[model samples]
Target: MITAQNLTKRFGAHTAVDDVSFTIKPGQVTGFLGPNGAGKSTTMRMIMGLDRPTHGSTTVNGRPFGEHTDPMRQAGALLDAKAAHPGRRAADHLRLLAATNGIARSRVDDVLELTGIASVARRRIGGFSLGMHQRLGIAATMLGDPEVLIFDEPVNGLDPEGVHWVRGFAKARAAEGRTVFISSHLMSEMAQTADHIIVLGKGRVLADAPIAQFLGGAGQERTRVRVSDATVLGSILSADGVSITQTDAESLEIAGLPPAHIARRAALENLDLHELTPLNASLEEAYLALTDDATEYRSDRTAVAA
Candidate 1:
């Protein structure tokens, strides 16, 4: 497991990470989410010992990353895809890392094949594409076979197939009881891959809970309904706490009332109900709502001249 307690970081006058704290337990995939400049990368860097925290502490498997005798074997991270030298061959880079970490050279081939880059093992790093670079970086992280895996935008340059592979790989690792922590802007992918979520905003943790709880707590549960007498049914359902939005001439989106209650009310009113479907909030919607105020960069939604 990875733990951060009151973790903080500052660069010059600006604080990047502010008193952040969260626990990434094993046996599950925890997604780290935030808007731009929310200090996610900074927190990951602190955990990897790439940058020193100005205050508080972070640990991997109960100790600082640098304190581990075999750091690579304890925790593996893919912070940057271009960390390897451009002059080195893909296989050479892995061999060098393995040699330093006392890992067998055979393990290099295993990871290269595992990441589906074995065919390009002899190629120079400078000639690799962005997707290939990401695969190579994943291969490096796997060379140690660490129990804790930290990936920062692992699918940044991947294709759809690559993204699917990564999602399955993360889940498989977690199934094996390894701690998997991933940071990505792909909400749809995170919704499918992560079992839990940790949201950061304005350099502080805003939400940390299971995916279902996070979504449920971000906004009220909405139900979509269609009936023969939509206008009259909406009027009957409208109340002090209930919200009813007329989506169309025949349908309505409602909140603050259960489906059973709406059905019962419609039955009592003799309204012909065609549909009553609960709308589960998407991760993107929940993230946007929770971090609405924490977003540092806001883009104008005004339409431009055609």
Candidate 2:
């Protein structure tokens, strides 16, 4: 398991990550999500010990990453695919990593097959496409055969098939009882791949909870009702503390009011209704509502800090 305790960092005067804390349980894929410049990469970098935190720390398997006996064998990470030497062959790069960590050379072939890049392992890194590079990076990470795997935006350039493959690979890693922590800026991808989600914005954690709890627990239980007579529904919903919005000419999106109240109101007023239905918010909707304020754009602010 991975645990972060008050992890924080400041670059000069600007704070990047502010006292963020969370747990990544084993046997599950936990997604890290945030908007652009929301300090996600900074936090991930701190976890990998690439940058020292200004305060607190994050631990993998109850110890700092740098302190591990075999850091690469204990935890493998791909902070950036472009960080590798461009002139080197894919297989040579993996071999160098394995040699540095004292990992067996045979594991190199295993990861090559695992990531589906063995066919192009002889090619130079400069000639690989984004998807191919992603695969090679995964191969490098898996060379250690680590118990903890951290992939940041692993599907950035992958096609639909490659995306599905990476998703399955993440689940397979967890099935082997490894701690799989994947980070991406895409909420849609996270919704499909993550068992739990950690939302961050403006150097702060907005929400950290299970996928079900986040979808079912965070937002209001609102219903979408469609009627032939939107005017009548609008008049009925104008009462105190009752919220309603006109979704279309013949439809109304109602919330903060129960379906029975709407039904009875329509019946008593002698109005004809076409449909009365509840519409629960999806993960995308919940995310937008939660991060509406944390968005980088603001009209009132004099200057944007980030």
Q: Residue 266 in model 1: shift from native, Å? A: 2.4
Candidate 2 segments whose C-alpha is farther than 4 A from its true place = 224-253, 258-278, 297-306
Tell me how far the alpha carbon of residue 263 in candidate 2 is from the true structure, in angstroms, after superposition: 8.8
Pairs of residues clashing in candidate 2: none
| Candidate 2 local lDDT, 138-184, one digit each (tens) | 88888878889999899989999999999999988988999998888
List the global CA lDDT of all models: 0.94, 0.86
RMSD to the true structure for each prediction, in A, is 2.0, 4.1
What is the lDDT for 169 in model 1? 92
lDDT of 1: 0.94
Off by over 4 Å in 1: 226-232, 246-250, 270-275, 303-306
